[model samples]
Target chain A: MKIVAIDRQGKEHTLEGRDGWTVMEILRDGGLDIAAECGGACACATCHVYVNDGWFEKLPAPSESEIDMLDMALAVEPNSRLSCQIVCSETTDGIKVTVAPE
Target chain B: MTAAAPIETDVAIIGAGPIGLFAVFELGLLDLKCHLVDILDRPGGQCTELYPEKPIYDIPGLPIVTGQELTNRLLEQVKPFNPQFHFNEMATGLEKLADGRWKLSTDAGTTLIVPVVVIAGGAGSFVPKRPPIPGIEVFENAGDGVGVHYAVRKMENFRGKNILIAGGGDSALDWTINLAPLAKSLTLVHHRDGFRAAQHSVNQMRELEAAGKIKFHVASVKALHGEAGKLASVTLAGADKSEWHHETDAFLPFFGLTIKLGPIAEFGIHLNENLIPVDTAKFESQTLGIFAIGDINTYPGKLKLILSGFHEAALMSQAAFHIVRPNEKLRFQYTTSSSSLQKKLGVS
Candidate 1:
């Protein structure tokens, strides 16, 4: 699977996503500047991302814990989701997301 | 301030994370006493600090364990070792003594001398998150009561000053309530109306705002207008993109904490990308008698995991024992079979 990430500078990078791996892991492994401080544990909201409009509905809804973490994140939008909570698979192929600011 | 007397121990561990906790057990097995220093007030490093309730599945033997649970278990396992812990302190300065010992100092003025120094600092120290505003750096550490501060070192410094507190967390709300009585003017600014802090604190802050003791604004700090390291005013951006300037002599932003390789960088050790380079065998740094493990250390095939740090602690203690007790011959024993090891664990 593949994931497209937009960095803070508005630069787009295509990352190879592994099945069952978190979006945060994929972005970090692909050399994207996602902090992922909790290492995909969904504890820290440093891996926050704004899911693209079309792709927001493609992934599963965030859990209550994920929503709680998002609430702690800065600049939270309706589409704001913790990338660490989003697992990549066939259904999430070609997912697009924009990384949130620090 | 006069420094306190130095504490002498067999090994001085820089962090109280999982790896450092386990190092106590390994070193204790060989009868090497340890003293650990951590920046956080408690143990578990990122585990307890970042995600205590988060479940970790990679720990061996156990299918799953929470971060706090793992820390509690490690604390229990090392209880018999009686490893001294100096919390709420960061290992700031490192120096080699003429007696072939290392002297470690902390921001809290704590000093420790040991033959071996183990750096289990995972991602370094947890420090306050700074607001990502341009030109904010100039306003930091501005002495004589004018600058941006993440923490309140002295309440007198903020007293009678126009202070602006940011974030809706406990620190901001608590400081708002405490400083409002003393400030000439106080403003609490946040991005949203809702707060992530305790309901009691939020209610208290609301009461203060209702009483007109403090100004509450649902806005984010956009820019800091300051000159010569002195903050004069801050530009705040509202939800509707409305911008306005607010006068303030001090800015306190408590957006929670994020870890960084802080004072560890100045320890005179060789660093690669802010991570200490260590050998895969002993996990020792370039400087003899000093070792780095866990996420803070980089080596061939190094993996940043709790389990990996556990293994590294085991090997590191073996090398640390040689340095701490060079005259004594090393004995390899397992906790599963050795009665002496069991005795050290207090099971026998």
Candidate 2:
């Protein structure tokens, strides 16, 4: 599977994805600026991202804990989701997301 | 220069995280007095700050332990050592003294002089997350309560002013409820209508909103408008994508904190991609009398797990002892069988 991430500078990079890995792991491994400070524990919302409108519904809905964590994030929107909670899979191929501001 | 006298100790540890706390036990067994400095108000570092209630199953002896419980246990274990802790301070400066002792300085103006410095800073210090607003720095620290403020130091400073609080967490809701009565007008802006705060606080805020004592809006502050370090108003991006301006003398955003390497990067120690490189055998950094452990240190086959940090702390303490007591012969003894060691732990 493949993942596409847009940098804060508006540059897009195509990254390889692995099953069972989160989009956050892919972004960090792909040399993006994703902090992922909690190491995918979903305790911090630093891995926040805005999914492309087309890809928003394709990903699973955020859990209550994720939503609670998002309350601490800045500039949260209707499409904002914690990238660490979105696991990469065959169904999630070609997922596109924009890195949220710090 | 700090006007206060420098605190003298055998060893100075930078962080009070799990590893730093455990290092106290190991160093205390060797009769080394330690002083720890941490940015957070409490111990446990990220464990307490980020996820105090989260459970971990990997701690060796305990089957499962929450972050806060592990911190409590570590505190109890190190109580006999009487290691001093400087909380709510960030270690910002490091210099080698003429006497070969290291002098460490904090943003809080406290200083420490020690023979050995151990950096158990796990992933660095947790700092308040700044909103990505342009020119926001000009409005920050603007005479206490007239401009942008991250934390409310004194509620009275905000009294009788037009106040705007942002965030959906407890800090925002609690401040809104408390400051509404004091402010000439109080407005709370959040990205969504739902709040993550306690139900009681949220209900109280809603009651205030209903009584027209406060205004609640489901919007995000997109841009700040101010002049001469005084905030005049803020541009709000409504949930419907429409924008509007709201007047406020003070703006407070309660975005949660994120970790940063912070001033440790300027401590003259070499860093490998923001992590201090240390020898696996001694866990000592390139600088003599300086050591790095936990997630802040990088070595071949290094693991950032708390268990790995505990092992590193043991090895680091041994090297620290040599620096603290150069003329004393090192003696290794098991705590279970060594009377001297047990005495230090107050278990004999």
Candidate 3:
């Protein structure tokens, strides 16, 4: 699957991920430096990222804990979701996410 | 050599995790001495305790490695230096001594004198806080068989069982989402309807509830019912003065633990939400001779990764060495031949 991550500098890097890996793992393994403190357990909000507006509906809804973590994130938006909690699937292909500025 | 005041070693490391161990390894390469301390009976800090079995896909060189194996590799890398280790002892307090030595007190009533302390605690010792529900204190020593659980690393523990999850935060939701597929029945109860997690997770839970994959309760656990010494059901009361009882086999409360900064806070260290603030490049704290590393240190552009912590430790060791021996030239000399070799290897 293809996931686009926009960094703080507005540079977008399209990463490839398997169906099972989360967005946080895909971005991190690709050297984008998205901090995921809880290792995708959704225990920490460090992996907060914002999804493109229209694309938000294309993905599964985040759990309540992911929303709680977005509250603690730096640049939270209505589309903010913890990247670790966003698991990739065939339906999530071509998803667009942006790493919020710290 | 001219006789001067007794100069202690360059740096003192306050943890033996990946960051602290990396500091030792780097400083040893620089031919500097380091003293490392940790409360864990062994090294690896949070990695050893929190997710020993989880495979780490990051960390530049290795494709994958378990937390325990990673810790072992780091220990092996630092073994050559013979860095002094103070294990099973927590650093209770820190004070700058008259001779410029850092005096550290342990909970065991022991004291250590060193220079340049590096606070490399990953989430400050990884002490899991138990929920404050009544009767929880009574079940503290009943082991995992009873209704007491300190952590939930895997979802299979609750699979095919009726599970009740508490807390309205990200961990609680993540657990709910993960277990919704495997659990026989799942109920998520929180203190408030508004969740403090990511918006997407909240949306996902609503969708899951709509699809009948799980049930959501806007309340907290008032009472837990047990049968034959194991959890059987949970009673949740809503804010609207409504109550419901659900039979459950496991009750996994994901309310985030209350993290304590402990004695490190007393060292006059600067912090943001209990996280020590450090210079991202140098890993040095506000106070001289006090450096912070790993997850505990927060700063602009601070990426809290094990690999990033390793980088911070390496740089901090060099800075600490300069602080201790300002006049001494370090052993590693960048000769023209070595520079050419580095160039050949595509290293700057």
The candidate maximizing TM-score is: 2
Using DockQ as the measure, name the better of candidate 2 and candidate 3.
Answer: 2
Stronger candidate by TM-score (2 vs 3): 2
Q: Which runs in model 2 stand beyond 4 Å of their true positions?
A: none
lDDT of 3 by residue, B189-264 (tens): 7755778777899999999999998988767676777754567777777777688887777777664433355778
Worst 10 residues of 2 chain B by lDDT: B1-10
DockQ for model 2? 0.79
What is the Cα-based lDDT of residue B273 in candidate 1?
88
Best by lDDT: 2
True-structure RMSD, every candidate: 2.6, 1.4, 13.0
- Count the clashes in each prediction: 0, 0, 18
The reply for model 3, stretches above 4 Å from the true place, is A1-37, A41-102, B1-10, B134-259, B333-348
DockQ of each candidate relative to the true complex: 0.39, 0.79, 0.08
Tell me how candidate 1 scores on lDDT.
Answer: 0.88
Q: Which ten residues in a row have the lowest lDDT in candidate 3 chain B?
A: B1-10
Candidate 3 local lDDT, A4-101, one digit each (tens): 88987899899997799988999989888665666786655667788995888878887765665553443344677888888889988899999865
